[model samples]
Target: MKIIVSADIGNSETKMITRYDGVEGSECFHQPSVIRKLIKSPQIAETNLKKNVINLDENLIAHITSSALNRHSDGLYVIGKKAMQTDLNKVQNMNIKLGNKHKHDIPVIMILAMIARTVVKDEFELNGALESSYQIDCDFVSAIPASEFTFEKAKEFEKRLTKGDHTVVIHLGDKKVMVGINFKKAKITQEGIPAIFAMVYDNEENDDRKVSLLDKFNEVYDEEMEPNDLLKMKIFHVDIGDGTTEYIYTNGVNPVIDACDGERRGVGHATEDAVIMLNEMLQGSFKSSRQSFMEIIKDKTHNLHSEAFNALEAAKGTQANEILEDTFEKIQNKAGNSVDLITVYGGGSIQFREHLEESLRDYAETINSKLLWVPEELAVNLNVRGLDILNRTVFSKNKK
Candidate 1:
């Protein structure tokens, strides 16, 4: 069996799109980038779990199922939303400054877990018959932060992913099913440049929905860009991630790598700040990881809901200012002051959109440059969308 995929192993979430033959499997899927090793694996699912956690628009699905992943790792691990439930859930610390995240076990584990999630999820849709144990060949495209991306680094990451068969065991209360994964191909594009490809390709039949986003972009940004204008424009992009920010310049269809660079410190700083404040409020009686803190902010009925929201909101506001200021400075240094357009996107971009839009719109008007916070449709999943497009492009070529 073969699974083609496009993934972005982000610090906050592992976002991906799985393809069968040459088309996307409905749409994208994301796993919270939380992983935890279990000393004792819990009893297999007693409760009937629902498929596809929550439905986000545009065929996107989130994974929350708990499954054990052993992809060249030291021990059995739980990932996605399931890992967040563990007391010792491990998340990639966004505080690390360009420290090569893909070099570690986390990326490999997350990628394998993502593939497993897909496999377990549309089992009947798979081309071949399913068994208790079957091997899957995976061809995929994913990206790493520009701050840490290099040809050599990418090659190393590719080697890490394809080294051997990865095992993912799914416990279904009565029995367990194990699936083996083989890396047929993997491509790690730098984060800063892929969003443009998102504008270029989409697998869905009713892709005209994307036009609404472009319309929104034009109306708010005071620009008159038709469908084809973005790809033709001299574009500057600021991708604000959890732990880092990247600046990439694209003249027409080509990315100017020499003008693309990134630095540490992004929305992760706010997340850390909120976590510290929350822990302090609890008087150190309990511990909460970044993942938990986010959940706290989302849960309004939680005891510390108000406190968590306020703390996170305040921290996010401050960090947004700092990140945007730092971004402009870096843009001037690397990508220069003038460009036909400027756009920003990422998970960080979504969380900090209000602040970013207000400031960036004014900043753009000041320089007479059009600005887009990159419509919500293309926001957090921008890189993965682009990578998926690239994956299809490659897959089509191979088929030919």
Candidate 2:
């Protein structure tokens, strides 16, 4: 059977989901959105190979791995957390995963790497072993920000991934393998639409994240309306990420162009500022990058916990306020009266909720509209989960 995967190539991380477990369930995978260009040379010690396990395409490569693509790209790179170990200064840090960057080779490579790693894990699970080389056929689905979710952008993205052969050499412990993802079908979905689809269709009854859309609609509207009316009611979705936040207005699953926009002020900006401030404040005594600072602050028992605990909190509050006043509040002021329901989600929503929850509730109450701060556990994966749901239902059916 051809593999079906739904992916979200986020700025801070990449999330991909597949119905590999079964039709009723899914397996979600994550990879850090980090990559670095590397030169495979004698400079890479044998010890480094043992640690990260990458092999060069040499005379011995034929004995250990198989090839499908005629020639690999000259730009050799490492991605995800492993890439983080290299020059921290040079690593592909937080950047908006939209516009030209969305269709660039790095993003495409990241997408393929996520798929390749997932396929490898599944292979190990199914067969209780690893493969030296594997090339799998797949149906790929991923999304960009709703603001850029246009026909031209989506087509360009699809062309970039499916236009040419995509194969990568991956490293394992003391070994290497070539894995390729051949996308039989590629789909680009808007960021928030899929989450709404998940809410309406794919949510589990017993799951705490399972929101009652119809029930919410009924409670809010207090009127019996046909299913067709569901398409007419406007629902605004606010998706917050580490590097970007998307404010989208939707009638059913379709985005309203005039009301939708994306901004660069996200949780990452706050953490980054905190990192810079803390570095200067302590005179480089406790050196921390953004990711390291976040990790340090989260771990209560860490040595730097005392320093990070409250400093980052202040930065977070300030950043959240900036985001609220600058983008979300403006969106609320302009569109509140016209919109029926407002839903807030995405990976970084959890961080901003403490500051935003009550204020949003007040506005929502004042405007006679309902608000949903999607449950934290479900927020991040909702988009990809929805895409996964479509992959099994609408997409497959349309293919038939």
Candidate 3:
């Protein structure tokens, strides 16, 4: 039977999907695109074969995905879930930073290969163990952001797969998601759409980090607000992440505005803080290396617990509100009647959902249309989902 596998690999997360015939299969396998290793026998380095896993120092690839860079004697290298156990001081590459620096599809290809290997290995092992008569192989269909999609790149990526080619698409949209179908296949037709930038730098001040349709609100909606004594309120939204924090602001119905002044906090620092606090608050799992904000808070952190914890207690939707409310209060004075409803989303949405909800409730009391707080899954994946929608629309139109 013919098989096609689609892989969506982003800096923050990796998703892999497999399909038989034309229908999407069950769950798509996924993993962080990181490998950790330690020096096993430095002197024994000689022959080399195809690169299977990243070799940091050549040990047994301890931990295998992430590891601490401690100069200590014991080589306990770790990667991914295992590497997250160490403090930021000890570990690096936890965020899996990838952008223009590396080849565009390098990270995704690595992740796809890993997924293919795992799936192929499992099928082979199980079939052999059960003494089955036949063997199975996999083909991969990798996807990239539609705005950034390219047929040449797709072809190059397919060539590297060696397993099989992948179908690539671009994901778009805000609350509603869409995808542009055959984005790689139709270069001329798809060129009209605006180019979307990867979230390399949250700040637009950087020359390379231009604003996108995602930041449409920031571009249009020309209005201003001065702090109003009546509401006596200020609001700020921060998209806290492993590498940086994104801040958006509003006084009262002036539309969400980007805050100019803020700190570039890393995910490791935020995670480290969360880990320390959770360590203090609870025992058992929290104390163990497996402890995550999702486990303790029973919500997603995407690695932004420290700020979310504070936001929750203050009844604010996002951590940015807590930190930058003062600035917003100043802008609230000249504002209109409508209280600004803050919508926060990202990998850290679940981390601050409870807090953001409380903040929205406060907005509802004074304003119309209640405050909005979209979760991380929807927030980050919104564009991809949007592209998918576009893809379907185009497909139907073409059929007609």
RMSD of every candidate to native, in Å, equals 4.6, 5.8, 14.9
What is the lDDT, from 0 to 100, of the residue 196 in candidate 1? 80
Clashing pairs in 2: none
Which portions of model 3 miss their true places by more than 4 Å? 1-13, 20-24, 38-79, 82-91, 94-106, 125-269, 272-318, 322-343, 361-367, 374-400
Q: Candidate 3, after superposition: displacement of residue 151 in Å?
A: 14
The model with the greatest TM-score is: 1
TM-scores for all candidates: the values are 0.86, 0.80, 0.41
Q: Model 1: what TM-score?
A: 0.86
> Ten residues in a row with the worst lDDT in model 3?
170-179
For candidate 2, give the lDDT of residue 133: 78
lDDT of 3 by residue, 1-400 (tens): 3344444454444444444435543334444434333354223342322222223212222211111111242232333443344453443343323322123433533343343343333343345321212223344333443223355654554444442333221111111111111112211111101011112112321233233322443323342322132133344444443333344344432223223222333233445455555555554234322123433344554454564465334332234355335324523542333334444444545554554456545654555533344334344543333233333334223431
Q: Assess the local accuracy of residue 140 in candidate 3 as a C-alpha lDDT between 0 and 100.
A: 37
Give the lDDT ranking, best first. Answer: 1, 2, 3
RMSD of 3: 14.9
Model 1 Cα RMSD, 1 decimal: 4.6
User: Looking at candidate 2, what is the lDDT of residue 341?
Assistant: 72
- Compare candidates 1 and 3 on lDDT and give the better one: 1
